[model samples]
Target chain A: MEAFITYTLFAMLVATALAAVQLNRLFAVVMLSGVFSLLSAVLFVVLDAPDVAFTEAAVGAGISTVLMLGTLALTSRTEKSSSRSSAIPLLVVIVTGIVLVYGTLDMPNFGSANTPANTHIAAQFIEKTPHQIDVPNIVTAILASYRGYDTLGEVVVVFTAGIGVLLLIGRLGRRGERQKQIGRGE
Target chain B: MRHHLILRVVTKLLAAPIMLFALYVQFHGDFSPGGGFQAGVIFAVAFILFGIVFGLDKVQQVFPTWIVHRLMALGALIYGGTGVVTMLLGKAYLDYSALAHHPEHGQHYGIFAVELGVGVTVSAVMISVYYAFAGRPPRISDEEW
Candidate 1:
C-alpha cells in the first residue's frame, strides 16, 4: 500500500511538472509548481521525514507560491514565445538528466539498514540525544544542540540574504528617502 | 481586491489562527515534527495573506518596514549572542552545556534560545522579502490576471 501511494505521488509529480512546462500562462504555471511542492511534501511524509515535509509544505508550497504570485503581478502574465530554436537546450537537458540518473545508479538501495549514512554518527546521535538534550524530537536536538554552529551559520546566512534583498529592492532607511527624492524630481 | 468580500472576510478569520499555529510550531518544535524555519515561514504567511487581501500599506502599518528590517538582524544577533554567552562562560562557541548547572538543562535552554532566534530571523526575512516584491508597482494590472 505504501509503495502504491509513493508510485502514485511520483506519477502525479511528473504530470504536474509536464503541465507546468507546457502551460504558457505564468499564473497556471505558478499554481502547478505549488501543486508539485505539495506532492513532494506528501512524499517526504511517506518517507518518514515529517520535519522535511513541514518545511517543504510551508516554504515550498505556501511561501514560494505567494512570492511567485507577487512576481507575476510585477511582471507579464504570459510567457513570451521565443523565436530561437529549443533543440539544443532540449538536448542539453536530456543529456544532463541521463548523466544524473547514471550518477545515482551507485547509490545504496532505499531504506537499507547498513548504508554508510545509517552506520555513521547517526547512530551516536540517536543514542546520545535522549540523555544529552532530553528533547523528544531528535531532529530538533541534532539541529539545535548537536549542530548548533551550523544552525547559527544558517541563521546568519538568512540574515545576510535578507539584508542583500533589502539593499537591492527594499525601501529602507536613507534609500527610501532617496527614492522619494527621485520620484519628486528634487 | 477591496470588493472581494469573501477573501477579506476569510483572511480576517484565518490570520489569527495561522499566527497562533506558527507560534505553536515555534515553541512546540522540540516535541513535534516542525521547528524554527517552518514556523517562521508559516508566521510570515499570515501577514502576507493579509497584505494580499487588504493592501501593502495596511499591513505595513501593523508591521512597519523598519521593524521588519531591524528584526532581520536581531534574530541573527540572538543566535550569535547565545554562542557568545556560552563562550564567555568558558565553554566553546555554541556549547549550551554552560547555560545551566546541569548540562541537559543547559542544552534545553540553548536549543530553545537558538530556535527562537532562527524563528525570528526567518519570519522577518520572509515578511521583508514579501514586502520588497509586493511593494513594487505591477507592470500588469489586476485585470490582466
Candidate 2:
C-alpha cells in the first residue's frame, strides 16, 4: 500500500512538473508548481520526514504560490516564446538525469538499518536527546539545540534577504519622498 | 474585492485560526512535527491572505511596513543575543547548558528562545517580502486574473 501511494505520488509529481514546463501561461505554471510542492510534501510525509513536509507545504506550496502570483501581477501573465532551440537543453537535462539516477543506484535501500546515515551520529542523537534536551521531537532538539549555530545562521540569512528585498523594491523612504520620486518617474 | 463578499467573509473567518495555528506550531514544535521556519511561514500566510482578499491598504493599516521591517531585524537579534548571553555566562557561543542550573532546563530554555527568534524572523521576512511585491503597482489589472 505504501509503495502504491509512493508510486502514484511520483507519477503525479512528474506530470505536474511536465505540465508546468509546457504551459505558456505564467499563472497556470505558478499554480502547477504549487501542486508540485504539495505532492512533494506528501512524499516527504511518506518518507517519515514530517518536519520537512511541513516546511515544504507552508513555504513551497503556500507562500511561494502567493509570492509568484504577486509577481505576475507586477509583470506579464503569459510567458514569451523563446527564439532559441530547446534540443541542446533537452540533451543536457537527459544526461544529468541519467547521471543522477546512476549515482543513486549505489545508495542504500530505503530505510535500511545499516545505512551510514542510520549507523552514524543519528543513533547518538536519538539516544542522548531524551536525557540531554528532554525534547519529545528529536528533530527539534537537533535543529534548535544541537545545531543551534546553523539555525542562527539560517535566521540571519532570512533577515538579510528581507533587508535586501526591502531595499530593492520596498517602500524604503518617507511617503512624501516616495511620492516625489514616483512623480519624477512620471 | 469589495464586491467579493464570500471571499472577504471567508478570509476574515480563516485569518484568526491560521494565526493561532502558527502559534501552536511555533511553541508546540518540540513535541510535534513543526518548528520555527514552518510556523513562521504559516503565520505570514494569514496576513498575506488578508492582504490579498481585502487589498493591500487595509492589511498595511493593520500590520504597517515599519513594524514589519523592525521585526525582520529583531528575530536575528534574539537568536544572536541568546548566544551572546551564553558567552557572557562563560559558555561557548549558543551553548544553552549555561542558561539554567540544570543543563536540561537550560536546553529547553535555549531551544524555546532560539525557535522563537527563528519564528519571528521568518514570519516577519515572509510578510515583508509580500509587502514589497504587493506594494508595487501591478502592470495588469484585477480583470486579468
Candidate 3:
C-alpha cells in the first residue's frame, strides 16, 4: 500500500514538473508549481513528518504561490524570454538531478530501530518527552522544550526576514501614502 | 477592491480570529503542533489579507509603519529579558528553571514568556514585511523585474 502510494505521488510530481516546464504561460507555470508543492507536502506526510508537511503546505503552496502571483502582476505573465533557454542550463540541471538521485542510493533502510537517530541522545529526548510533558506528539515536545533553543532561533530568523522586507519596502510605502494623499486632493 | 463585497466582509470577520489563533498557537505551543513561527505567519497572513482586500493605505492606518518597526526590536528585547531574569536568579542563560518559585513550574513560566515574546515579535514583523511588499509605491516609470 505504502509503495503504491509513494509511486503515485512520484508520478504526480513528474506530471506536475512536466506541466510547469512545458507551459507557455508564466501564470500556468506558477500555478503548476503550486500543485507540485502540494504533492510534495503530501509526500512529506506519508513519510511521517506531519509538522514539516503542515509547514510545507502553508508556506510553499499558500504563501509562495501568492508571492509568485503578486510578482506576476507587476511583470509580463507570458513567456517572452524562451529564446534564452539553451543547452547549457539544461545540461547543468540534468547533471544536478542525476547526482542527487545517485546520492539517495546509499540512504539507510526505512524505520530501522538501531538507526543513529533512534539510538542517540535524540532517542532520550524522544523517549522521555511523553512522560515529562504528557504530550502524545513527541516531535512537538522536542521542539517546544528539549530543543527549544533551535526553535527560538528559527523564530528569530523569521523575524529577521520580516525586518529585512520592512527595510526594503519602508520608503516605498511612504511614497505610496503620499501619492494616495495627492490623489485624494484632486 | 471595494467592489469585492465578499472579500471585505470575510476579511473583517476573519481579522479577529486570525490574530486570536496566532495568540493561541503562541500560548498553546508547548502542547500543540503550533509555535511562534507558525503563529507569526498566520498573523501576518491575516493582515496581509486585509491589505490585499482593502487598500494598503488603510492597512497601514490600522498598524502604522512606526509601530511595526518598534515591535520588531521589542520582541527581541522581551526574549532576551527572560534570559536575563533567569541569569539574575542564578541559573544559566534562558534557564526557565528560575521563572517560578519552584524550578519545575518556573520552566513552564519561562517558556511561556519567551514564546509570547517570540509570537509578538514574529506577528508584528511578519505584518510589517507584508505591508512593505504590498504597500510599495507605484513606479513613476513602469519597469519590470
Candidate 4:
C-alpha cells in the first residue's frame, strides 16, 4: 500500500513535469496547471494535511482556473510558436526539477505516519481539538472557530472580487447603450 | 433549444426540487456535506436551467434583473447586520455567542444566518452574471406563469 502511494505520487509529479514541458496551447497549459495543483492537493492529503489540501484545491484549482479562463477569453487562445523558444524555459525547468529531487533526498517517504510534521503542531491539533471545540469534524471546527478569522478574511476577499467584477463588467450598461446607438447609425 | 421537448419537461419539473434542495442544504448543513456554497450553486443551477429551457428573457420576467441586483446588496446587509447586532449586545463584531440564551446554540444559529446570506448573494450573482453573457435582444413569452 505504502509503495503504491509512493509510486503514484512519483508518477503524478513526473506527469506534471512532462505536461509543463510539452503543452504549447496557452489554454491547455493553464488547464494542466490546474491538474498540477489538484495533484499537489492530493499529495498534501496523502500526507494527512486535509486543511491545506482543501484551501489549495479551492484556490488553486477553482479560483485560479476561473481567472485564467477569464483572461484567455479577453485575449487570444493560441500560443505563439511562430518563433521557437526551444530551450530556455525547458532548461530552467530541468534544473529546478533536479534541485527539487535533491531536496527530497532526505525527506520522509509518502504516507509515513511518523514524519516530523505529523509529530508536531499537526498532531497536537488533531489530538487535542476534540476537547477544545467538541466538533466531530475537526477541520471545519478549526476553520470556522479557532482559525475563523482567516476564513472570514477569505470570505471578504471573495466579496471584494465580486465587487470588482461588478465594477468592471456590470458597468457595461452604459457601454451597451452606446453600442446600441452606434448600431442604429445615430 | 426552444423545440427540445425533453429539456422543456426536465427544466420545468426539476426547477422546484433544485430550489427545495438549495433551501434544504442551507438549513441542513450540520447533517450533510452542503451549506451556503452548495445551496447557492444549486439555486443558480435551477435558474440557469430555466434560462436554458424557456429562454433568458422569460427568466428575467420572473426574477427580474433589478431584483437580483438588489439582492446582492441585501445579502451583504444581512451578513454584516449580524455583526452589528453583536456590537449592540456589548460584544465584539460577529460575536454570535451573545445571540441566544446559551451562547453555544447562538453560534449554530449565527452560522446558519450567515450561511443563508452567502447562499442568497452567491445565487443572485451567479444567475445575474449568466444573464449578462447570454445575449440577444429579448424574447416574447407566449405563456406567463
Best by lDDT: 2
Ranking by lDDT: 2, 1, 3, 4
How well does model 2 score by local distance difference test? Answer: 0.94
> Cα deviation in Å at residue A172, candidate 2?
1.9
Task: State the number of backbone clashes in model 4.
Answer: 0
For all the predictions, what are the DockQ values? 0.88, 0.90, 0.30, 0.16
Clashing pairs in 1: none
Separate clash counts for every candidate: 0, 0, 1, 0
Per-prediction TM-score: 0.96, 0.96, 0.84, 0.66
Which candidate achieves the best DockQ against the true structure? Answer: 2
User: Could you tell me how far off, in angstroms, the CA of residue A63 lies in candidate 1 after the best superposition?
Assistant: 0.8
Candidate 1 local lDDT, B25-122, one digit each (tens): 99999999998999999999999999999999999999998899889888898999999999999999999999999999999899989999999999
Error of 1 at B107 (Å): 0.4
What DockQ does candidate 1 have relative to the true complex?
A: 0.88
Give the distance in Å from residue B48's predicted Cα in candidate 2 to where it truly belongs.
Answer: 0.5
Q: What lDDT tens digits, residue by residue, belong to model 3 across residues A64-177?
A: 776676666656668776667579998999999999999988877788777787788877877776555555566656665567677668767877787677656556366788
Ranking by TM-score: 1, 2, 3, 4
| Candidate closer to the true structure by lDDT (higher is better), 2 or 3 | 2
Give the per-residue lDDT of model 3 (tens digit) for B28-106. 7767667666676677778788888888889889888888878887877787788888889888887776777766577
Tens digits of lDDT, candidate 2, A89-130: 999999999999999999999989999899999999999999
Whose TM-score is higher: candidate 3's or candidate 4's? 3
At residue A131, what lDDT does model 1 achieve? 92
